[model samples]
Structure formats: C-alpha cells, structure tokens
Target: MTGVSFHEFRITDSQRLDFHYEIDSETEKKTGEIHFQSNIPIPFDPDSVALALSTMCGSAYRRVRMDLRVSPRARKVVESFLRCELSAPARGGVTPERRRRGNVLSFSGGFDSLAALRLMPDDTNLVSMDFGGRFSTEKPFFDKFRPTVISTNIVGTDFQRNSWSFMGIGAILTAPIHAAKYMTFGSILEAGVDNLRRLPLTSRGQTFPPFAGAGYRNAPYVAGITEIGTAMILVTYCPEVVNDSLASLALPGEEKLYRKYVLASIAAERAGLTVDLKEPPPPATRRPFGRNFTADFLSLYIRRFGGAQVRDAFLTDVPAEIDALSERLALTFYERINTTIMQKFPVELAGGLYERAAVAGLVPYTEDDWREYMIVRDALAPYHPTVAR
Candidate 1:
C-alpha cells in the first residue's frame, strides 16, 4: 500500500454482489469494499433523510467531504427509498415568522461585524458589546461608517482561569446585559446559544432566564432574546456533524467548528437562507478579514493544525494575552480541562459568555468554520497547548 490508493469496482448482476479493492502505491496498504443486494430495499422511516444521505454520498452535499460510489442498481433503489419511508416529513416553513422586521448584526467594529453592519439597511439598529474583549472600537468604527448607529456596551464573566474549556475564551454568552435593552423588538438575535446561556448573574442572584434548561423558552433567538439592542443567532450548519461529535474533537476549535456548522445551519434553515457550510462564506459585506465570532472553527482547526494557530490569531489580532499568561496559568487550566485540549498551556479567558454557556453543554457537538482561520490558528496553537482551539 502507498500514500495514495484508488479502488476498482465490479458487480455481478446474477449474484447481486459487488466487490471493490484498492491498491495504494505510497502507503503500501490494501483496502477493499463489498456489498450484497437483498430481495428489496430496506425501508427507512425518514425517506428524505435517505435522499439526503444518498445525495450526500455524491459531491452535491457541501457539508462534509465524503466519497461513496454505488452501483446503478443501488442508486435506483436509493431513489425509491423515500417512497418507503414513514417518518414525519420535513415541515416546510416550520420556522415561525419573526413577528416584526429588524436586523441585528453582532456588531463588534471588527472587520466582519462592521462589514455586516455597514451593509445592513440604515433603519436596522446598531448594537455593540465587548464580552470583556477589545470590541469597544465598534462605536468609533460605526461612526466612520455613519449608519444611524445606536450602540451599547456589555460586560461578561472573567474566565481566563478556565480558557481550556469548550467555551470561546472571550466570547460573550448573552451578549451581556445590553442585549436586553433591545430584546423588545419582537425580533431574533443572530448569535449562538452558548452566548445565551452565559448571561452574568447580578448580586440579586438573577441573570437571563435559563429557557432551554427549563423549557420556558420556545425560540431562543426571537422569543427569549430578552436583551435589547442585540441578537446572537447561531446561523451555521455542517451536514457532516450529527449529534454530539464535537466533544471528542482534540482541540476546542474543532468542537467550535462543528457547532458553527450547526448554528449556521440552524440560522439558514430557520430564516430561509442558503449557506455553504463546507466553507466560509464571505460576510454579507466586503471585508479583508472576518471576525471570529463563534467557536465553531476552532476545534477542527486545532485538531488538524494544533492550538498554536488559534493562539496567534487571537493574540495578534484580538489582543489576547496568551504569551503573557501561558506559563502563569498552564497547570491551573490543565486540572479543569480534563478532556480535549492539552492542559499544559495557560488559557486565561478575559471571561465571557462562551465559557459560561459551554460548561453546561458538555455532552458534545461541533462547528464548521475550520477552513477559514486555520492558517493563523495553526501557527499559534503550539505556544498555548491548552487553549488550542
């Protein structure tokens, strides 16, 4: 076997058998594939799922990189699978219409957010917050863009002590209290749920209500987006991810990548939008660099390129004090981040929503923004091994 291998396929109609063998010239490995036909197609409960899977086996699906070749007979049988399925059909327009009209971009004055905000209609509200990160530049940036901007500031928890967790080291969970100021628009916030769960509690022992945990919230985006001026909607999807595959990702970024896909997917799905989850789509506006808003890209990135890439991107672009804190907090984080990232690296989070929301949803999930940020993130992960994602 060699590093590269190609498979040859053969099928026998009389026996209803298929055979495949692969020869790798570089890796010097031998592999094979085989299949046998039954009297009929095995019926499935979800016919559309079968179609989706079958369509996914080809290059048509953009969610994952998959290569599955089937015989014409199998292809035909698969085509009929939907007819045999009994599962509930996908409800078209299942997502409720936003009762009102309003557009809210997670405006950070960063390249991506600013660009997104700049492109939105002037009537759209302008909101900004810094999950304790350096996003205050948002207002000034908007000032120059001059798009009828009305902004607010938000503060998040300090999680530098627990940077190695699945949370975004500095991302705000609830977009801070500022979001509540604008939650009355009868609109949806375009951010992730991780941010929703991390609203800071006041001395009164009160914070944003935990709707998902308690079932009090129907729509995390619109109905429960109680905060004013901002909405954090997870608008990404990666078809490859199913269930909680993100938990096992070696780097937090990879897990974030899986979740980004889910978020982006859910966003587009609910909003009747089409997005390419396999790759980073240009921000709705033109920008040189997109803001790293979600944790979706980090996990896959760290797993492949290591946490060093993520570290450099954060420290160089976002003023993350990774180098200053690496030695100081390495061992401290190692004890808490028992899974995923390497614990030896110090990952003092400036504290934000990503950490607060993630500590609870540890079951496992993933995102899909890995390809875009891999370059910078890969280069930086080696220094901060723990907060690699």
Candidate 2:
C-alpha cells in the first residue's frame, strides 16, 4: 500500500484500547490493541493515540494520513515526522492539558536504563512496555523500582521492523497520563553518534520535536556517556542488579564482543593489570556500520587497559591516519558530555548529574576541547564512505 489512514480508537476494556486503520484506499481495515495497567479507564488524548499508531505501522507506507481528532499543537508536531508524510486534522478546543511536573523514564531494566535511573531525579516515574512475554524475565528487576508496566503486541509483523519511532512511543503516550514534564530514555553515546560517518554529535534532532510538541521534553539521561561508561555506573552503584538484568539480546556479534571487552577492561582497571581479550575482535565491515559502539568501547578499553596490541586489533581495518583520528575522537566522545545537549533537562538536575558523573571519575571536556573535537571531526568526515562519494 502507498499510504495508511488512522480511522478510530475503541476502548475494548478498561485497560485496553483497540484501534482501526486502513491501508492506502483499501476497503478493508487492520486492527491493533494497546493494554495499560491502570484500574481506571485512563483518558488518552486522541492525538497521542494517533501518533503512537503512526510510529508502530507508518514506516511501511509512504504517507500516514490521520482522520482522528487532534489539536493544533499536535498538527504542528506531526510536521517533524520526516520519514513519511503524516497528516492529522486539527480539532479546536481539543488540546490536552498537562500541568504536573517531574519526569517519566521509559525504563527497560537494562544496564543503560539503570544508569539513567541513577542520573535522573529520585522521584522520576518509571514506565516499561512489555512485548507480550518477551521481557517477562526482567519483571522482578523492574518491580524493584515500582514501575508501571504496559503490555502490547502492536508491532508484531516483519513489515513494522523499520518503525524506529516506536522506541519512544510508550513514553510519549504515557507522558500525558503521568503529567510528566519530560519523557526520558536510556540512550547512550553509541546510539546517538554516527561514528562510522560524520559525527552528528546530537541524538534528539528527529525524536525531540514530537515530544516537545506534545508538551514533554525527550531527555536522554545517558546519551552523553558510552555503554562502557554506563556499565561502570551500574557496577559502581547497582552491582546486585548488574548480572541478573544485563543482557545483549539480538545485538551484533561485534557489539557483544565490545560489551564483553568493557567488563574485562573494568575488571583489569580494578585489579591494576592489563588484561587480554578472551575473544578476537570482529573483522571490519563497510559503512552503515553495525558496530556503532566499537569506537567508544575501544576508547574506554584503552583508557583502562592501555594495551597497544589490543587497541591495534580493533583498528586493523582502518588506515594509519584515520585510525589515529578515530582513537582521538573516540576518547573525547567517551569522556565528554556536550553541555548544550543537556539543555532539555532541568537545570539543577543536569548540573547535579554532571557534577556527580565527574566525581565518579568521568571527565567533562571544556569549551576549547569541544571546539577542537568539532574541527577534528570535520577532518575525519572526509574518510567516511558516504562523504568520499
């Protein structure tokens, strides 16, 4: 189908909402359901529900046309969905009001989320989306934080695999329910920086607009740090939850290696010895790199272990000059959190988190260092496969 149209949403039960949509101009329609954990029938704004549906199935088609009721504010937010042409009719006086303060985290019970939990305000509400029984094992870990769990099998088909927007859809939908001022994620540096290409240095460009338009800030508490850095935080703060909660489900083999290397590096650092990698590094591949976290992992590995042999093993595919540049960039990327990126977070919270991170041994780069990193990043951009074209 060339397009998809959202028709309406029906409350199947007190905790469930069944939605209907049509593909292109087809007479037949498709149905999906979302289940909440609340006892009372929660009042969900039509605009948020429509946006959630679009994020789940919109990517399969070229256009997403929403016929549901939406406010002017929602209409403006839909403009930021650059992947597809999404249209929503505006309904006057339908604006959803949210006056409550504080934050809600889309917690996944993973190392990254736990790290984000450490940095966020102690009162931040925790919310988790359960994909059927896939993540049931982590329920005990999640229960410790007293999180609200929402179960749904909305993106069950292969066609919906490219619906990356669904990552934050839960936080978006629940933000209004909780009246949260911000919707935060556990995203790390590797998830944000396109290190295999030119460094964008920012992760929120696409996702932030919709959340902001919906009156909630998309704040990633762990975006400034690397996975290894988050592991460090988890090890330092929540050692008991580390072994049971951390799992690299469906991650690339190289990423798995990188994660293992992180743990090894941390152990070596604590033991005051250089440790050898138990497994060999994965051979290098082309652009649209699957190993986005490799550079950050390598940087931390070198900082903790400083073994030339191990460092060269990971950079074997790169040219000598580019290898040097990558090491420098990677080190800086792991060490620094660009203060500008923290603007979306509350001033006191951001400052406190930064200070705590520094006290915990994570270095913060200065303005001069940031300028130098940008200059170096521009020079390294030429080496990217896309830029070379």
Candidate 3:
C-alpha cells in the first residue's frame, strides 16, 4: 500500500456532491470521483465531509493526506476517527447545524438491523443507504420525515471492499442531510461481543476490538463534532439477546412474536410445508444483501484454514494450558494470514487490536489471548499482490 490523497469535495450548483481521490501505488495508479445526487437540500462543511470520505477509503493506504485545509476541530475529529492514520492541515472552527428530527435507523433490512428496528421506539425515523449499487425504496409514511436514500453507485470492485467504509460511515455523513439527531446501526452487541468471547481467534474482523471499539469512539466523534449523537444499538441489546452458552437468548419482548411464529409453524406443518429450523438459511442464489467483499475475503481465508482448526489446535497441543493455547492459537491464526489475503485488515488483526478490544468493556476475553496477525501478515508471503493494501 502507498499514499492515498484526497483532492477535493464539492457540492455542484446542480445539487450533485462530488468526491475526488487518487491512489498511487507501485502496481496501480487510480483516480476517480464519486458523485452523489441529492433530491433534498443538505448543508455540508467541505473539510468535515472530506475527512469522512478520506477516512472511509484511507484504509487501503499506509499514508492518507488531504489537499484541502481542515479546521482544528475537524482535524481532531478525523484523528480520533482514523486512529491518527491521516494527515491534514488545521485552522479554526466551523460547525454545521445538528438535525433535530430525532433518531434515524440506518436500516438494511438484514436480520440484525431488523431486530434493531423492532427494539427501537416506533417513532424513530428510518434512513436506508444502498452502496454497491443497491437502491433504497421509498416508503410513503416516511415522506413527512424526508427519509434519505443514498446511492453510492459502487457495487463491486477491489475498492468496494468494506460496506462500512461507505454504508456505516456514510450513514453518519448523512446526519447533516437528515438533520438526524442520532444515526444508529443494527450492529447487535450480543452477536459481535459474544462471538468474540466464544471464538476470539476466529471471530469476525469487525467483532474484534480495534474495529468494534471504533464504533464507540469514531461515530460519536463524527456525530458530536458534526452536532449529532451516534448510536450502536446492538451494543445496547447484547445483554438482552445472548446467554452464557454463547447461543441466542430469547428476548422477553419477542415472546409474543415467537408464539405467533410457533403457531405459523404449526399451520405450516399441518399444510405439509417443508420447514426445518435445523437447516441453514438457503444459499444465496443472488448476491446476499449487504455483502462485504473485504469481510468475505477474510472469511474465506479463515475457512480455508478451517475455523475448527483453531480449537483443534488448542485441544491437541495445549489441552491443560489455556494461556499457552491462547497464545499458540493467536500465533497460528497470524501465521495463516502470512499465507492468505486476510492481510488487508492488518491493524484489526494485530495484538493491539484485540488488546484494545479487551479494554472496551464489552464482552470479556482472556488477557492471555494472542493476536499478532498483522505483524505476521506484513511479513513475506509466497503469492503475488493483486491489489495493494
């Protein structure tokens, strides 16, 4: 990975917002602009907008620089947002008006997000975004609140790596447009945090500390600095949804819904409809909703090594030594990265990433757990680099 530069962000007189960025690496030099068409008038502060966009895309580069001057406040926010991986000039203060239109759920109609929607107050506004070329549908009831539909026009590519880079952060960026008080995601705390505890070495990348903790810091920094609050609704629901066995816990509020589902199940049984809760969700014939390429890449790499291998390594090698197994499994996972494409999320897989996650006060992991995955990832690998990271 080389340097990535942010050139400019402009809202054209034609109600189009444009973002210009360039990536200069040894293998490839690419430059392009992203155009966002807005039907409703939305105020934007150029520096803040540039910072947000740059941070979202800057993960690919070792160095990130902004051509436009940034206010001191915005610079601080950006530093916090990207964990000080970016560079930009700093001046004085410039604030945008925070929307008073109450909370907005960044809905994706996914299981987790839908669960969050059910948990939220009925009046909470729903704001949906479609990146990777998916388009959000308009709901007539939401018209009064001026529901937002963001189309990034990017469906798939090497750059179309992480959905959060666009979808998650993009929702925060829309706060000003929606006059949104809090931009919430359906990120369930129980699934992510519990998954981390149950499978620390093999948990999903986002479930790890550096990435998850960022939710606590980054979103709020962006929202507060931009004059709105950030919401990680799933974190709130974790205690209510997961149990000690690392399985899904029934939500008290959903008991009635569950009963109804049970009755429907009985009806389906009487009608001879094939229904089996033990079976997995049907394989996606079409691209699954909100599919993230980067996560997919990491998951495929992990699955290639066999997720069960981590535990097997533990059972076979360090049956009586939990600490030894923890460190060994961490190193094993790290070494696997040395031979795979999971290197992209280097920092997230690093020891520091998990260490930071440990202190995040979410779910608990043994302090002895190891995570030098990034250090190992940066080391020599046998394959050629198709795209710089």
Q: Which candidate is the best by TM-score?
A: 2
Q: Which ten residues in a row have the lowest lDDT in candidate 3?
A: 221-230
lDDT of 2 by residue, 1-389 (tens): 46666556566555666555555545554544344343334555677766666566534667777667777667666645536656766688856475968888888887778778887777998877766455555666676777776666554653247466676666666766788887778877556345224334453323455566657766667766766567666655666556555432212344444444455456446534443434434435332222333453343335335554555444434445544655554344444565545545565467758766664456566766577556544544444333222
Best by lDDT: 2
- 177-218 per-residue lDDT for model 1 (tens digits): 112221111222123322222233221111112211111111
lDDT of 3 by residue, 1-389 (tens): 67767667677763467767787888998787766654555554455365446436635557778766766655555555554465766656556444254456666543344444544445766665555322222222223345565556544533456334555544445555545444455443222212212233332333222222222212111110000000112222332221110112222233212322232233234334444332122222322211322222232223233343422221222123333333344432311111121122333223432233223221222233124433322221112122213
Model 2, residue pairs in steric clash: none
Report the Cα lDDT for candidate 1. 0.27
RMSD, one per candidate, in order = 24.1, 5.4, 14.1
Task: Tell me how candidate 2 scores on lDDT.
Answer: 0.58
CA deviation > 4 Å runs, candidate 2: 25-41, 57-67, 79-96, 132-140, 158-163, 195-207, 248-254, 257-333, 343-345, 366-389
Q: How many clashing pairs does model 3 include? A: 4
lDDT score at residue 122, model 1, on the 0-100 scale: 46
Predict model 3's lDDT versus the native: 0.39
Q: Each candidate: how many clashes?
A: 75, 0, 4
Assess candidate 1 and give its TM-score to the true structure: 0.21
